[model samples]
Target: MVDTVYLIKKPAEFPIADLISDNDVLILIQDAVLRQPSISNWYACKEDVIARGIKIPDNKLLDYEDILNLIEKSNKVVVW
Candidate 1:
C-alpha cells in the first residue's frame, strides 16, 4: 500500500514537488488529466481520459474499481 493517494481534479500552476513524497500516488481526474507532469507514481482516471480524448498509457489509467481499491489500500487520501 502507498503512503498516500492524491486525487487532483484541476490543473495547478504551482509546483507539487514539495507536496508529494516518493511513496505517494497522484491520480488525475476531470481537467487535471490535461496537465501531464513527468513524475513517478502518476495515474489518471480512465473515464475522464476517455471523455477528454486524452491518450494516457494503459498502466497509468485507473478505472473506478481500481480507484476504489487504491483508496482502500492507501494510508491516506487527499482530494484537490
Candidate 2:
C-alpha cells in the first residue's frame, strides 16, 4: 500500500486534508496540527498538540514517533 504525509504548516493554501484517500493515512504536523478534521480516521501530531497547548479531541491525535513509523513503512511520503 502507498501512503502520503502532508506536513502542513498552512491549512488554507495546500488544504491537504481535502485530498485524503481511503487507502492513505493523513498525519497533520507543525502548526497545522491545531486544526480540526472534518473527516474520520485522520490524525494530528502530538508534539504540535503540546506546542500549541491545545488538547486534541480523543481519537484525533497521534504521537510524532508514530507518524515517523508510518512514514518509514509507507510506500511514499509527501509534505505540503
Instruction: List the global CA lDDT of all models.
Output: 0.87, 0.70
Off by over 4 Å in 2: 14-18
Residue-wise lDDT of candidate 1 within 1-80, one digit each (tens)? 78999898887831367888888889998999998777877999999999999798999999999999989999999888
> Model 2, 1-80: lDDT tens per residue?
54665556655434445577776776677777766667665688877888889888757777878887888878777776
Please provide the root mean square deviation of candidate 1 (C-alpha atoms, Å).
Answer: 1.5
TM-score of 2: 0.76
Q: Give, for candidate 1, the lowest lDDT window spanning 10 residues.
A: 11-20
* lDDT comparing candidate 1 with the true structure: 0.87
User: How far does residue 12 in candidate 2 sit from its true spot (Å)?
Assistant: 2.0
